[model samples]
Target: MLVFAFQISRSGKSTYLQQVCLVVILAQIGCYVPARFATIRVVDRIFTRMGTMDNLESNSSTFMTEMRETAFIMQNVTNRSLIVMDELGRATSSSDGLAMAWSCCEYLLSLKAYTVFATHMDSLAELAT
Candidate 1:
């Protein structure tokens, strides 16, 4: 099944993609896995993005928070999971980010899970061809 939640004003693709990942993860928890003896693993490589937490007090820096969030995404992903990732290294230099994004795309292509990657890296678009 597919689930999408997006708006015309903003880039809602990522949000909808995340929803698909969540659904896939949940579905895998029950009949899907037990029937096929399969597992769900998701891996993400998002660029700079805010954490779900909303804190007014002092805390980690932006860079620290980004790293932590990325780590969390990766740790939570499973093989049978659907990965919804944004630009991988967008917070860093362009070249660095492109390279990171390229590698991530390659990694996902290697995996058997469904992936929805959102990025502005047209260079990597060649992968689709």
Candidate 2:
């Protein structure tokens, strides 16, 4: 889902996305979640793409590294997979990034995986409609 609130810019959305994935992980590991009404869907795998992730030692730019990771996710993720991508398309020019994000969103929607995508591009929220 596209988070629309401007106040969530302080990494709150990223944190929130992490919590959801963590809950599923905790549940899968047999840890009892203290929820009065919980129906956590069982998933095969969890993939995450944190925006600032980079492999500096390998001489890979953050954008290149993230692109490789994103490609891997698209290739490996399944309907039962859980995906959390934060600030996709932010490593390049704004227009380029938004274009990439837009296409990625379309692809992710087609896959029907449980996905949580967080971005600072407010225009992306329009895609929800």
Best by TM-score: 2
CA displacement after TM-score superposition, residue 93 of candidate 2 (Å): 1.0
Minimum summed lDDT over a 10-residue window in model 2 is located at 1-10
lDDT of 2 by residue, 2-119 (tens): 2332235685887778888888998988898868778888999999888665688888988999899889998998888888888888788999999998888878777777788877
Write down the TM-score for model 2: 0.86
Model 1 misplacement above 4 A: 1-9, 25-64, 67-78
lDDT for 56 in candidate 2 is 80
Top candidate (lDDT): 2
The TM-score obtained by model 1 is 0.55
Evaluated against the true structure, the overall lDDT of model 2 is: 0.80
